[model samples]
Structure formats: structure tokens, C-alpha cells
Target: MEKEFNKKLNHLTKVNLARYSTMRLKSWGYLYELESFHEARAVIQELKKQKRPYRLIGGGSNQLLSSWEEGVYLKLPKADLHLLSVDEKKMTLSCDASTTVNAVLQLAKKYSLGGFEVLTGIPATMGGVAFMNAGTSLGEFSSLVSFIEWIDGEGNICSKEFLTSDDRAKNFSYRKNHFCGEGEVITKMILKATSRDDALEEKITKYLNYRKETQPLSSKTCGCVFKNPAKEMPAGKLIDGANLKGVHVGDLFVSTLHANFMENRGEATYEDFVALVQVVKEEVFRKFHVELELEVKI
Candidate 1:
């Protein structure tokens, strides 16, 4: 049975998880690089049969890692999936899960499909974006999502369509989307698009420039560390007001450019990152009476 499982699983032993995550922490885990939905279902079956726990990750952009104990780490592969389709009349693009948000942005640019331009600089897969409902102040991936298709725990593919005007869709509020089911692995998404216009391109350029000017985009960081407490109360401002910038626990330092970002100066450990988070959270809460919640996932 182990031999048969090995035959079906495309995997690596004792993986250096730093290579998988953008944060570059030295995390170790068993990794399965899934090739197809059939392989994914097979892996789930084998893990269930063996009673081994497992988790799925994509892009690894929003993840912080320390170690994994006795479980399978599944990737939908970093490879780009098919673009599926582009409907000019309806102004939509259907993308597969493995595709990156950057890839989607490029497609939007290619076809002059506007609204998605705000998502340009985010480094995440379509699956991760859908999972986290990732976005910036301009807009969120969830807002654009027309439908999400995923593979459930029992290996059944399911689709959930969302209407923008629906009250349930409104539940996908700031930095959160509740569309995903427990043990459900996202497979594809339909994103709303708009007609090409130079004005939209101009807006995209403006947002990109703003990010470069404000964020530590070139540094080794996991983007934002804390979610905004309110629409008017940004985490960065709170951290900065608390005078927490440049605080370091080992090599992990609060970015001087952006307080919400923690940079890995050199040889930072997971413990150091966690400690840094604790310090920031405590300081922000103590100074402002606001308890900051982590935006980055572990």
C-alpha cells in the first residue's frame, strides 16, 4: 500500500519550505506537488486510508512557517493552469487554480480587461487569492468573483456562484471571504472584467506607483502582518503611531518603510517572527486599545 501510494504521489521528502514561502524562513515539511485533480483525489484517499493529516498551500505568499509534524503538505503546483476562457461580451475571465494573480493581471492587461488592474503587484496564486479573498484598499478578489469551483474533502468537485448584490456575498467583508468550505480545495474562479480603457490603465499605474513609494516591496516580507482594525483605522498607522517600527526580534525586523510589514534581515527564524508579532500586537493594543489580528497565516 505504501508502494502504491508512492507510485501515485508526485512528492518530495524533507523539503526546505523556505523555498516555497515568500518569507524565506527555514521550515521543513513533506511536500506533494499535485499534477492533476485525479492525483489530488488519490492523495486524499491515501492520506485518509493511512490516517495522515494534510493541508493545501498555494503561492505561499501569505503564509508564515515554523515546522510541520507528521502530515502531508500539498501544493496545487506553482505551474500555470489553463486560462480557461475570456468572454468579451460578458467581460469575464475564467482562470484555473494554479494560475498566479500576476498572471491574471497580465491577462487583464493583454485583453485590456480593466477592473483587475488593482491586483497587479500581489504575489499569490488564484487559489490562494480565492482562499484568502486577498485585496488592497482599491478592491478585493472576492468582490470580482462570480463563482468559485473547488474539490471537496470526499473528492467531489463543487461550484458556488455569487451575486454582487446578494446579502450573502456581502458577508465577504474586509480581508475575509466565507465561500470556501471546510476541507474544500479551490480549483477555479470566474473573475469579473471590464472593457479596456486608458483611464483604467492610468489607475493601475497610479496604484502600482503608490505601493512602490509606500511598501517595502523589494524586501523579504510576508506583505502585511496585521489586518486593519477598521476601514478608517489601518494597522500600519497604529503600529507606526505606537513607535514600533524598526523593532527586531533576531533578524526579523518591523520594516522602517511600512510598520505593517516585518522584514527578514538575515537568518530569521520562525520563533523570531512570532516574537516580533507578539511585541507589535502588545504594543499596539497597549498604546491604542486595539487588539491587532494577524493578517499572515501560519
Candidate 2:
């Protein structure tokens, strides 16, 4: 069974990653595009046996890749992104981890389910969102997640249930989560909607409009570059106040529309992104006396 599974794995060497990432950095790396959860489990086991390193890539919205990567990268096929189930009576929705946030939002709207407006304008998959507890000023994804399923490093499936009061404290926090550690991959999730709103469309439109007005949504960016230090002091405000807006290093620049976002003008390199981040961090820290934490993964 292991041999067959290993043979089924689809891999590529020196794969161009410009299309995989939102930033579109000119980068290359090895990749494994697994077709199903079983394939993912098998790949994990094989990697363990070979003592090789691998990381999962989802949507590539919040990641910044270098010019070249050494280890293997794994991705679930887009075919796995399906709406598993929806129980209106329970106000619950289940979906594959590969499902995009936009797709999930559409599903919720179709069912007239609410409580996902907080995720408006986020370009990410369910797995990536759950892994990072992605959110906006409204609330975090942890608030809606009732159950999570993932594959562990040892090639075993694992899961956890979250109650209304325990999800935030037990598993999630500001732009971070305790689950989905190194080598683990989130497979599916069951999210509980807070209400059934017939006006869900209007709500989502408002949210999207707000984001469009405040963010450089049309530009190529990996969402927010840094996490907000506190509710009162947002990273964008700090960076803007420090006069980092429109600052550039190579082809990357701090967005004037939203200081928290760094935009790729054209053909930006990984080194340029890193240099820009360091400059912003140093400037923000020197002025605010607070060290900003990266929301974008490297």
C-alpha cells in the first residue's frame, strides 16, 4: 500500500512559484501536488521515512517565498475544495481545507448563513485561515470553527472539538494558533454560523467596500505585512505615522493606501521583500518602541 501510494504522488523539481503566491515573487522550488487526503497522509509517511522536510502551501496569499527553496512543498489539488455539508438547523457548515475563503463565503450566502463577514477580502484557503486564525477588526476565524481535522507528522489523522467559550483561549490567539504545527496539515473544518441573516449579501458587500476603500485590493500584495500590536494601535497606523508609506526597496513598496500592505510593483525579488520588511520593522520599532510581528510567512 505504501509503495503504491508513494508511486501515485505527483511531484515537480524546480517548479516556478510565481503563480502559486499572491506576491508573485520570482522564486522556484520543489513541489508535491497531492490529489487527496490519503495521498497527503502517504506523502507525510514517506517524508518521515526519508527524513525529509516539507511544508504545505494553501492559496499562497500570506506567504513570501525566497529566490530558491531547499525543502519540498506540498499542495492539495483544487479538486479537493468542496463543500462537504451544511446543516441549517444547526447553523453549521463543513468544507474541505482546500476550499477558498471566497468559495466558503459564497456557500454561506447561498444558505443565508451569517457570521463570516469578518473574513471579507481575505485571499486564502480554509486550511490557511484556520492555521493562522485569520480575521479582521470584526472577529477571528476561531470564533466560528467548531471542529478541526488534520494529519499529524506520523501520518495519523487527528482532530479537536471547540466549544463556544474554549476556541479562542485553548487553540487560537491574535493572528496565530496552537494547532497545525510543523509538518501537520489541516484537512477539513466545521464552522458554526452565529445567525441566519437574509441580509448577508448586503453585509458582505459593505465589508468588501470598506476593505477596498482602505486597502490596495487591486494591487499584488500578500495581505497585511505585520500583525497589529493591539486593538488601539494598528500596524498600518504605526507604519504610516513613521512615514514608511510608498517607500520602496527594488520592486516592492509600502502601500500608500494601507501602510500594513507591501505591494509588488513588478518582478520583485525575495531579497527585496526581506530588505523592505526589515526597514519597516526598524523604523516602526524606533518610533513606537514596539516591535511589530510579521503576519506574512516566509
TM per prediction: 0.92, 0.94
In each prediction, how many residue pairs overlap at the backbone (N, C-alpha, C within less than 3 A)? 0, 0
Cα error of candidate 1 at position 149, Å: 0.7
Backbone clashes in model 1, listed as residue pairs: none
lDDT of each model, Cα atoms only? 0.79, 0.85
How well does candidate 1 match the true structure, expressed as C-alpha RMSD? 2.3
- lDDT (tens digit, per residue) of candidate 1 on 12-80: 577788877788987788878877655777788778777888878788788876688788788765544
For model 1, what is the C-alpha lDDT against the true structure? 0.79
Model 1 misplaced stretches (Cα beyond 4 Å): 1-12, 167-171, 194-196
- In candidate 2, the residue pairs with backbone N, CA or C atoms under 3 Å apart (3 or more residues apart, or in different chains) clash, namely none
For model 1, state the Cα shift of residue 128 in Å.
0.6
lDDT by residue (154-213, candidate 2, tens digit) is 877899999866655888988788977866888898999988889888889998999999
- The runs of at least 3 residues in candidate 2 whose Cα sits more than 4 Å from the true structure, single-residue gaps closed, are 1-11, 79-82
C-alpha lDDT (0 to 100) for residue 242 of candidate 1: 96
